[model samples]
Target: MYRIPFDRVNWTTSSFLIGTALIALFGLPVYLYHYGANWFLVALFFFYLIATMMSITVGYHRLFSHLAFKAKLPVRVFTLIFGACAFENACLDWASDHRRHHKHVDHDGDPYDISKGFMWAHIGWLMFKLNPEPPMDNVNDLRKDKWVMWQYRYVHWIGLVVGLIIPSALGYAWNAYHGLDPWIGALGGFLIPGIARIVVAQHCTFFINSLCHTVGRQPYSTSHSARDSAVMAFLTFGEGYHNYHHEFQHDYRNGVKAWQWDPSKWTIWTLSKLGLADSLRRVPDSKILLAEMREARRKAELHLEEIRQQQQPGQCQRASDKVHELVEKLAANYHELENAIAERVQLSREALNRWQNETRGIMREISRIQLLTPA
Candidate 1:
């Protein structure tokens, strides 16, 4: 177990994290029992939840951290405002840590390195100031953005007012207009939409660092701990395709597939259409396919080698022969696939399609061999 450094404890962050969670846990049930699910309050909570979570995932993570897309002032302002409400940190600090995380992922510099432990990655890192404060020199580009600087100067004030006070005021007004107790309504709003939403939204982001690195499929690359999870995507508004995100960090979309639930990707696309965003970076389909093929080929080769090693000298001659044939086939097809892609600029569409089809068939065969291999 990792020891908590009492002297290194960040009292402010620790208090906020623990206090908000405790209030949400204990206060929410009491609020529900008294108010019996007031629709206005419930709607407010959902509204805050979606806004804050989206701001962090889309704005702080994608726009600021990775520079995945360029946003107009309105989009930037909105994201920064609610992104602050998530209370993760100012854009400058958040982006700085995130850039370091990618530049030195899973190594000493990663702010929330999962190798440390699930709890450490999830929240312990934030609770305690175990490491010395690193300079924000990485965010030189962001430092030029006036809006980001403005938010950095007053993030906590914005968070307190827009995140908590505004919701409470709205709740009070709603109750007053409806001839109900405004005081109770205000308290309910502060507790539910304000505090509880923060706890949930913050955890959703933390899960990307903890659970994303711990479980899920790493089809793209195992070089890093990052993996993809549909459940995490759902919780985080489509930020859960961690494997793909790590593999192609500059791509605007985490969920790279057509059917993947990446609302952040969709939002950026929609913003582009509306002239609110532009310069959305994306990894080409060919490149993505190449990555998949390479990983698949590598896994197949490992499985085949294992099967060959396991085969008795003469007892499993047939299986050994089959493994050799599959290995030859895999190598030949993969080589051809690479050549075809390399000459894609000069190749006709028809020829590329034929090569792709042949490669897919080879991959299917490789998959079968992999499945047959004993765990």
Candidate 2:
């Protein structure tokens, strides 16, 4: 068992306790009361959820942490401001810790390791003072930007004022105009949408650390505990593809497939098209496929080895041959898909548009076939 060090006790903080209490007290009550059970509130919540999730995935994770894409000044600023409303933390702090987490995943240094426990990974790490001071070494890239620095400096205050106060004020104004009870509007708008949103949003973002690591499939790399879960990805704006992310951290899109529910990737793509973002980086398809192929081969070889240890020499050889045959077939299929994608990329706009639909259908069929095959 891993022993808890005495120094680790310093990790706990009152902010964590207070934050948890506030979330439970305010969020649960409002959520139970309004619960957005109706179509209107449900629609509103969905929009809020998408916006907030994108702020974390696209803005904080991809933009600030990995520098996977560049956003226009206004877009960057807007994301930063709205992201603060998620109540995760300043972009610099969150990004720094995230970089560190990727650098030291599943090790002693990883800020949130699910092996420690589900709750610890979800929120306990945030409650403690893991480091006496905010991590500065991992955040040099963020320090160069003045806007980032400003947000980092006053994010908490900004969240309270803009996320909470502004909403409450607006609620009051609406109530006054409509001749309704301002308190009801304040509770519905500010308390429900503002504080409750923060609580839920924070947990959804944190789930990637806890649930993603513990309860998903590791198809890409088994070196770490990170895994992929479609359900978690939906909650986290496509961040639940933890295995692929651990394998290829620099890719702007987490859920690379079009059908994957990655609002973060969609948001960045939309922004890029509208000239609000640029320099969107992605891992080359060749490299990604190569990694996947290598991992699959490794897994097949391991299974073959296990069988060899248990079976006769002749049987072992036959199993090994089967594994090799499967690897070769899969590799060839992947290469064909890659070439098709490349060809599509070279087509004219009209031709490309026409080919994309057909290509997507073919790709979907290929994925279905691949999924049916044993990993």
Candidate 3:
């Protein structure tokens, strides 16, 4: 690998990340032959993955970046600790970069601009310094958070302690209890959940940047690279609904539907029920309906535009009657499309009304219960 003079490759970041890749690639095969993995180590792999991942999805990304919902101090602390263990960056830095990504998207100032290519967006942006100067001006809101700021100030030390040291210690302890040699246990901890887990987890985040944008449907917004993808949601733990996230950035839910794979949304809601989170943000159904209608309209218009281009004056000059027939058919189809669009909007409006009525009934019931109970 060629090193550039101006590239602000933070050696701390590059060394650990690159070292992990090397370990996962070369070290894993050697280690597996010698000690082999046990059920306990396998369990650690999943446990740490979920714990650290939620710290980013629920903590660093949504809670800090978008402020989709308010969390209790304990929740924040939990997320902060696990989030640091993920080793992406400081909470402030991650949130600041995310806010900029949303604000600029594929245009200038987007740190991971997909326009540069999928590889670039996925991981290259981190390896090389694209913006040169870090943008502190964007995240003024997060600055007010004492915990977030403190995390940013000591993120490097935090990463070292929480990310590597703790996992390694836990691995050694687990192995020691099983009567295995201390060195083998230490090696297992350092490699399995420590390095391998980080490698896999980091790529999941990268997939959101690369695959989520490249592969999904943009039912919510075609103006950006973001798209809605269920496969991605499965892999990235519900961050795959990029289209909705880009369109409704403030909404606490990524997978808004009942069946959508959004564990993050579930976590936030569960915490809210426990009084650990509150003011969960949700976009109104009416707004979502309107966006759907707009998208349908855009699709129809695009189809019409393609037809218009194909039927240029010179292309149809030899077949006047055919052109007239096509025109009549198109006119009818256009009218039908218009009517369909209207009907879709009407159906959505009715559904929204029904939902609202149901919500009101629930609220009233809750209010009655509250009134009956003494504070």
Candidate 4:
């Protein structure tokens, strides 16, 4: 069991996290029971939810942390404002920690290393301060941006004003305009959209650190604890594709598939169309396919070895021969495919297409080979 280092407790952070969560848990139901939810309150909750959640996923994680894309000033300012409202921290700090997490995943230097424990990755890291605070040297590029520096200087105040005050103000004003008791709306706003929304957004982001690492499939890479979860993607605005993100950190799209539900990716694409974002980085499909094929090949080799170990020499000779045949072919095709992708820049379009098709065929063969192996 992990022991709390009371001496090193981050009182402010702990208080805020615990306080907001308690209120959201108990206070929200009570408020609903008394005043009941109105369309204005529901709209307010969703509005804050989308704005703040997108700010963290699209703005903080992708744009700022990975430099996946560049955005215009208005976009930057808007994210900074609402991102502050999410109350995670300034972009520089959040990005610095995130970069470090990727660099030192599941290791000593990772801030929220899941290897430490699920709770630690989720929120314990924040409530209990590390003896030595992480240095800020990693974010020199962000420091050069005046807007980021400005937000860093006053993140708490910005959050209070925009995240809480504005929502309450809007609720009160709307009720007043409708000739209702404005105080009720103001209270509802502060509790539901203001406080409750913060808790929801925060936990969703935290889920990326905890649940994403814990309960998902690592299809892209098993080098780290990161995994992909469609459920988490829905909750985290598409950040649930953790394995892909870890393997291809600089790619702007987390859910790389055409049918994947990555609202953050879509939002960035939309911003680019509106001329608000540009220079979106993407991993080459060939490279992504290569990663998948390599992992599959590794698994197949293990399965072959396991089969050999389970059976006596010359037993199941046909199965052994078939496995050897598939494995050899896969390796040869993998080598040729690697060369093709590496020389893709020099290859004509038709030639590249042929190589891609060959790679896809090898992928299908790998899948079928898995079924041939004994359960």
- RMSD to the true structure for each prediction, in A, is 2.7, 6.2, 12.4, 2.6
Clashing pairs in 3: 227-243
lDDT of 4 at 319: 56
TM-scores for all candidates: the values are: 0.93, 0.79, 0.82, 0.93
| Model 2 quality (TM-score) | 0.79
Q: Give the worst 10-residue stretch by lDDT in candidate 3.
A: 366-375
Model 2 agreement with the true structure over 1-375: per-residue lDDT tens digits: 966555665443446446656865866576557533333334444556566767888888999999988999987788788888787889998898899889889877788867778888988787655556544698897899999999999998977886777666765666677787766656555655566666678888889999999988876789999998899898887899888888889888888766877778888899999999999889765556546655655665565456445655334254445545555555565566467566754434464344344434433433332211122
lDDT by residue (83-176, candidate 4, tens digit) is 9999999999999999999999999899999998999999999998874897877888999899999999999999999999999998899889
> Could you give candidate 3's per-residue lDDT for residues 1-375 as a string of tens digits?
955646566666568778889999999989999889988778888888998899999998889899999999999988998788788988988888899899889977888889989988998788766567675887888888898888888887886787778778887898788787877877887788888888988999889889988998988789999989899999988999989999999999999878999999999999999999999999867666456555644554454445455555555332333333433443444344455556664445665555445433432332232111111
Off by over 4 Å in 1: 344-364, 367-375
Residue-level lDDT tens digits of model 1 in 1-375: 956589999999999999999998998888888786588888989999998988998899899989999999999999999999998989999999999999888988999998889998999889989899999899999999999999999999999999999999988888899999999888987988999999999999999999989878887888999989898889879978999999999999999988899988888999999999999999867677667667766776777777777765555355546656766776776677677678865555576556567667765765565323322
Give me the runs in candidate 3 sitting further than 4 Å from their true place: 1-11, 311-375
lDDT: the better of candidates 3 and 4 = 4
What's the true lDDT of residue 146 in model 3? 90
- Candidate 3: Cα lDDT at 308: 51
**Please, what is the whole-model Cα lDDT of each candidate in the order they appear?**
0.86, 0.72, 0.78, 0.88
Q: Is candidate 2 or candidate 3 better by TM-score?
A: 3
Q: Residue 263: error of model 3 in Å?
A: 0.8
